[model samples]
Target: MAPKHQPLRTALIGLSSTAATSWASRAHLPNLLTEQGRSKFTITALQNSSVEAAQAAIKHYNLPPDTKAYGTPEDLANDPDIDVVICNTRVDKHFETVLPSIRAGKDVFIEWPIAQDLAHADELVEAARKSGSRVGIGLQRRWLPPVLKLKELIQGGSLGKVLTADVSFYNGEEDPTVLPEKLFYFTEKRYGGNPIVILGGHSLDYIFSVLGNLVPESISSQMQIRRPEVKLVDPATGKTIKTVTRDTPDILHFTARLQPSQYVVPGASFHYVFRSGQPFPGTPTANFTITLESGQIQLTAGSPPGLEFAGPGQEAKIKVWRRGSKEAEDVEWKWENVNDEIGPIAAAMQVPLYAFADGKEKGDGWVDIEDAREIARLIDGFYKKWEQDGGL
Candidate 1:
């Protein structure tokens, strides 16, 4: 474990009672409470929509008795002891929740899909830059052991020259006719909660991470919403609550051509196909295939949104096939033993925190807001293309 002079004081925004069962609680809090993480980070504050909620979160999570609880984001941001502000809110709340922290010169860690649109992302980047604040975005899949190994193999020429790559993700929520009450906002485009922005954004980030410096020369995309209206269903009882019209597209298909490919050296032609949708019958959650001149590499996970939420003990399933091989070979890579106590999501969440702390001490290790801006641009490109082709 890396030595730390003192634990970094941390504050959490949008951490409420509801978070106990949400992704933030499942993936982040447990990791932070681990022995290794406790050595690096100390939870000092909690912020919620109301003081009651914040206080409730503090009690629910068994935080330090002295941990401050604040109703407003500004109050938490201005706290002198907060060294890191972690925002795990809904997509639409990110901009407002984190802006004060950035302005106050506190390093921040925000979950993926930094903002609802490119413009908001650009603004956040600018603010962080102006304040000289270290910003970390939760594109944590890149830190997964399998993903790291894949990058090493590609860079080391294990796959020879790259030929083509294809990625398909199914979120398993395609039945727009039924959504949980918490997910009702996803049906509205204005909130930027659609699969295209959330799931597609992460998919693009992971793709770029594996390709390493490959820039797209051309992009073509199509987005469509197969179900115009969706019903709200009670998650526990599986009964419909109500029906509402949905404007956001549930399906996204895109193709990109990368320049300077391995086959052509400084100028090789590389192609990629990206597809995402709601959950469908007989469809795997996610699959990624990369074909090279000499061999092929493939990765699949049960839950498609991100590897971070992969099922327990099944973070990623990887396979490799060579030209002369009779069948594909399974690749075994285990996560660090220290992370074994937590679920896959919690294990992945620990990565960004480590990077954030390392970057604060050593000056380089985490993905910043600039990376978020790039992803936002990529997502915006799809929207623009869809507009040009007329709405589906």
Candidate 2:
């Protein structure tokens, strides 16, 4: 790893925008500044459409007073001291906002979906390629602890000949009219829809990162929007409202074929289900489960410490069972604090950078423009298929 003191100087552009404000101000920026964060990087500049908002954010976060605040993304991108450009703009504005930085040969770390559509994402990737820039998309789940453990067990052959795989998630999507404006694109056909294109995209990325070589042979799905009366209220004024319409699918359920080999038995099948906005009364709040040919591994979270604002009783558990045995054994992992399992999450965040840094040290890096393009292709293809399915 590079010397901690020689950290990268990063200029954050467009964070004051509503789309990036909460997550950037609360999670991304703080993580970048703390010791547990990228000790080698500092937020050298803050760019926003509104200088006042940026000023308030900087003060709220207790960032260095000298951190330059700009009224536009271009201003921050052009700063000579900025070695990296962090793009946290809205889902639709990423390409436009980050392209200039790429043209200027600055490394970029942006949130997922890269853009509302693949072409825009590809345009940014092409610019990055021409400029020899590094691009890192925020698919942080790949760096989460439970996932790492699952990867180890699967790769180590602990779950010999892995069999069927299933993934499911319920993200609130029922009331379209009452939905927040910021989240409305999530349901608009123009923007990537529910789990399939959005969550499913991340899920597939993680799946491929760990499982390797799993591809979609066929996808059949049905989609619906339960709530259309939802309205988006202005954050500052609860009285103001905007009603929008969305044609995006709220539910995505599909099945895929996993190559039959020593990993499992022949004809291994994978199933995935994603739903939006459903109440979980007696069920576990959040769960990521990996059921193997031999047994199953489950990660569960409750209340204060879990990711997302889930209700109480958060815990992480692992269960194992030998093939052909009815009995199963379970083990529990440690939590770093009462508010978050962030210790493990924070540690996991370093893997990508470590991989990239190691590659850089060896005159090679794992993250590049091409990888971003490939991810874009995957996102594009998934949506195309969804559309062809008659919004199923």
Candidate 3:
């Protein structure tokens, strides 16, 4: 581990400037360049598809010239000076990219939907266990301000006993006939970055963030491949590049019965509905609410729904309406501690860095490897159920 005063020597893999939906650029780098982020960590190296690609990224990202560049995960893992590695590659690329780092006994953080499925996610979990390297997942939703405030309110008994939770998130798909060329694999089950796991998983993660007592003991599901054919288009341009099969779920619905908890009475239920290929019509992209014994709480996204993606100027508004109140009062919430320039989304990525630098294994919104495995495993069960239902 790096010393308390010294920054953690860090390495970033898959930090591409041209990739489709570059989360590495949007949700990660900005925070690492901040004053506090710099004090806590330093970029020692990078691992890209090739050595030349890594060098290109170094220049693109404006890191120090002395930064070493590697083409392979093993080569990056072999660098003893690199204390931590952050992987932001595609979901299918995650297992191969981070396994070496875990075996090398270096700390790691990988973006959500940890792997292709439960099998790969489990393998990473076991590797981290054997190597004893602390691992964190990009389940940064719990740290978002709206989620944090909801957590405080629910857990503090501000809403009384929780009875039921209902969540609805719509991708608001911009084009019904087109998908991004690079994202073709995202709609395939084989690649494991489909709407089911990415949107469904994050929805569950955020809801559980505020309502931990509602952890599903059992789930019943219904899913359908609503869009079987889609035009693969250039993201920057609307022109069609190709047409591909969209075999993944465009509509997913689930009902869960939670295990008993102090804050929730028995028979409490959670219902989730996700729809792709359709945009919300002048309404909050997400409409979520919790029904409590004495009152209720509601959350809606000003931007697109889900804590998995956050951009500048986006907001999640929380409102509370008690039994005695005439109307719901808005709950004022904001991420005050972080620099406003970085915004809440990218700033959430730094929470684990500081935790790891301080030698702690856990902190708010930090989902460890095992926690990540469970989410993947749970979502895997959804697929099995879908299969059992003949991919309805």
Candidate 4:
């Protein structure tokens, strides 16, 4: 009800002061403060666990003086002036945090892992469908410059038909051996933000989304926890706080045949290995090798290796090796004009939010609740396959 075509009045959920819990503030605030963000939406309100928390966040973010604050999802969702609600709560809290907003017919954007599990994600999908609310999932890695460039190259036949892909990603930064006190929840599968979901899920989502929307035909997977316990550390002092039994898989290796599609060659085999701890010595954090009939393309980075965001300096570059070429060529890729403070991650995130705000763009890269459900299915499939093989 804020006049048609005018900037949407938006409410932010889970924008806290702590860096560990406030991913929304870290990745979103920059883009939301940009010229494009300002033109498309306004931060009209905030909701945290308590009214004081919400008010503190609003003050900390330096949002407008009149920005409203609410302590609960229901209160925030019921605000008639709010046109959009963006939730950046923990993975396990996703369902409850955004359900009321979606049901209230408020456009909602949720961080990935859309919900704790596929069942919850399915319900949210159905709810969004019934409510006819635009729900954006934070599966924004596909919008990264390198990803789009790969898509362009593939569709344009720069790499010929992709016959197979081998993705070996080692999440070195957030290793399985240790967790900061703040991130200890990640060691448990119950939290739903384990390596399989964070590293494997997001990476696979981007990889397949760029590769002609390929779906897994038949997947065989193995999961193992190399570490029995993970040491919890005081993030500030790097001192060990305590240890908890590791309930999450540290090594996940899966091989699958992708269903034939317009882009991928028939019988395309996709092999993925997502390791929880440090990368093998002298190796990149993540290595994605796409084998095409004519040449090969590999994207290696020391960041998440998932290519969600860039690593330090030239570590995030992609190299293209044609069959006849002496060596691979470094492909040039860059993001559009973004605020300097936003960095590559937020800049990548801006695409989906902009698409949502404009309400014009559509397709595979535009991740909605339905697409989130699909990704959740993909995530669930891996676990099912792992269970079928029996736990390690």
Candidate 5:
């Protein structure tokens, strides 16, 4: 590891005490405060919907008294002290929230599904390129220990001649009965909060990172809105708020055949299915199965109703069964062993952050904005296929 020099000054947008339990607070903030992370980065500014909210978050997190609080993203972007801008806002607001920072030529890290749609994503990419600013997306699953190990095992020829891969993700969020008032925005596909982009996209990124990027030869998809009318519940009172009609598809299934590529025999393929709103009762939230000529590898991660970030008490498990071995071998991974200061999810997230910082310092250590745009295009393909097939 390079010796720490000046810490990267960072500003977090859409982070506040009001949403204290958000992914940003749980994963990003905690990781940044760790001893190891603090050595590399410093939280110099915070932006929320209002100055009062930002100030409250500063006090709640007990940040340095000198940390600046801004009501608008423009103010934070204009602050020369900030070296990187981290945006954790909703997908719909991503383009606007990150635009000012890009225009100011500042490196930015935006959470996954970079924008509401491909058009918005293209605009951001163009702006970043023109300004020569580095952009990082929150596709941190590739950095997870199990994922890294899987990639290493495949690349090292442990899973010789990969044949096929299957991934299934089931979360009960799409259920109309469990909808929350605050999350009603997710019912609209235009907001880019559907399961296909959130869960399926992450799973696809994980698969591609391990098997190497494959060109899609063909694609078939099906989408349906099982629960059109959803009842919203108030978290505080545990009472029903109101019912709203939802048009977004709650269930999505897609399969694609890849051209003969690396990491596998001539015709390796991929298939994924994501279902939301349906109750899983007592089943794992996510599972991955990869088959190769020599053996098979399986992974189980997160719990029921799983969000992208692995929740507290949830750990990932991986098992490998080779043709010659009598019994499957369990793979163990501890993030503490890699970096004691940060949690597993945070450690994964730190990969992109470190890469972004390194690119700023050393000139080339981050995922390209073009790669992020490609993922966005892949997502666009899914929606297009659904429409062409006459969505259920």
Candidate 6:
């Protein structure tokens, strides 16, 4: 059921070391390069704002000599060989970089926040719509097997009624001053706003992915600045420097309502918690508890890949039990990676990508997009309520 067109052509437009390792290197490149993905797309080129950086990455990855390396976004956009552009770049530069590709009728996969706010995301959504190009946001967690299973169970009537559900996360990294400078992505808000917009956006987006559609009735959030500032030494000279004015919220808490009781996954409520600067001692861990009208399910997700950036000991576990049943059973699934599972988890989570590439999964490609946009709208709704309530 592959696409009628020949294999999709792809290129990487930002080759920073961070982008190389964080995503393109770990998941996108490796997964797409597989024999299975080879049938769908080929990684044709690498680009960067700097020629030296792009060339170094090309040589380091040992790409073919014909592989093009660019010193600017325009160069890559003009390269007719690339049909799909994967952009992993600075947050501020996302809208600018991806717009060119959209104009050229090349589909694009861009990092999250699509832009700093809703207007940009909508604009990008509209441009792609007009150009007949596909746009993918890198919120890969929605594709996880466990999540998909949960969604299916609800949709299939196995859960009967998902009465209430909760999702929570904890890891130690509360102090922004101590984090690496490159992590400004999380620390800066005006560029993309705070964790509520960034981190919470991803988690909430996935929750919407599971629930189908949501109408956020109310939202309340609080942000705290624990350290205020931090010092870092020059990597080469060992000179110390202090940074000031960390405005983003390291901690975010909120709640919203699901739309239409009819669409409610039967017995569902969501609770999410995230803690930074307080790393759990063992492996990184994420867990959720669910209560169904007939059965109960508990899920714990291990911190994989970039989560390691949050620090060690990551694992995922899902346990289920029938009401009044004597015993509980654990559902076992394969781990995607040994060194760093974030890649594998992300790969597994990309269910829609495979569905789209295969051409037979059902619905237009935007089935997931519809779910995501509704979630985005809800989150925006929550933010508006927060503004009304003096949350800022």
Clashing pairs in 5: 174-277, 175-277
**Ranking 1 against 3 by TM-score, winner:** 3
TM-score to true structure, per model:
0.91, 0.81, 0.94, 0.94, 0.89, 0.81
Report the Cα lDDT for residue 24, model 4.
88
lDDT of 4 by residue, 291-361 (tens): 99999988888777546455555346788999999998998887774446777767778888877777744
After TM-score superposition, what is the CA distance of residue 171 in candidate 3 from its true location, in Å?
Answer: 1.5
Please tell me which model should have the higher lDDT, number 1 or number 6. 1
Candidate 1, residue 375: the lDDT equals 82
lDDT of all predictions: 0.76, 0.60, 0.80, 0.80, 0.75, 0.61
* Candidate 2 backbone clash number: 24
lDDT of 6 at 53: 82
Runs off by more than 4 Å, candidate 5: 1-5, 172-176, 277-283, 302-314, 324-326, 337-341, 360-366
Task: Output the TM-score of candidate 4.
Answer: 0.94
Can you write out model 6's per-residue Cα lDDT over 282-345, one digit (the tens) per residue? 6444656767778877766566222323223344566778878899888774444423323553
Error of 1 at 56 (Å): 0.7
Q: Tens digit of lDDT per residue, candidate 1, span 1-392? A: 24334588888887677842386787788877888878878898888888889889899888988989888888888788888889888888899999999999988999888887778888898999899777788877777787887777678886687677777777755554678877888888778767778877777776777775445556666787677888888888988889898877777776665555554244333444344444355555777888887888988877765776666644578889999989999888877833456877778777777778755442134577787677888778877777777767
Summing lDDT over every window of 10 consecutive residues in candidate 3, give the lowest-scoring window.
Answer: 305-314
Query: Against the correct fold, how does model 5 do in TM-score?
Result: 0.89
The deviation in Å at residue 287 for candidate 2 is: 5.4
Model 3 bad stretches (over 4 Å): 1-5, 213-217, 307-314, 337-340, 363-365
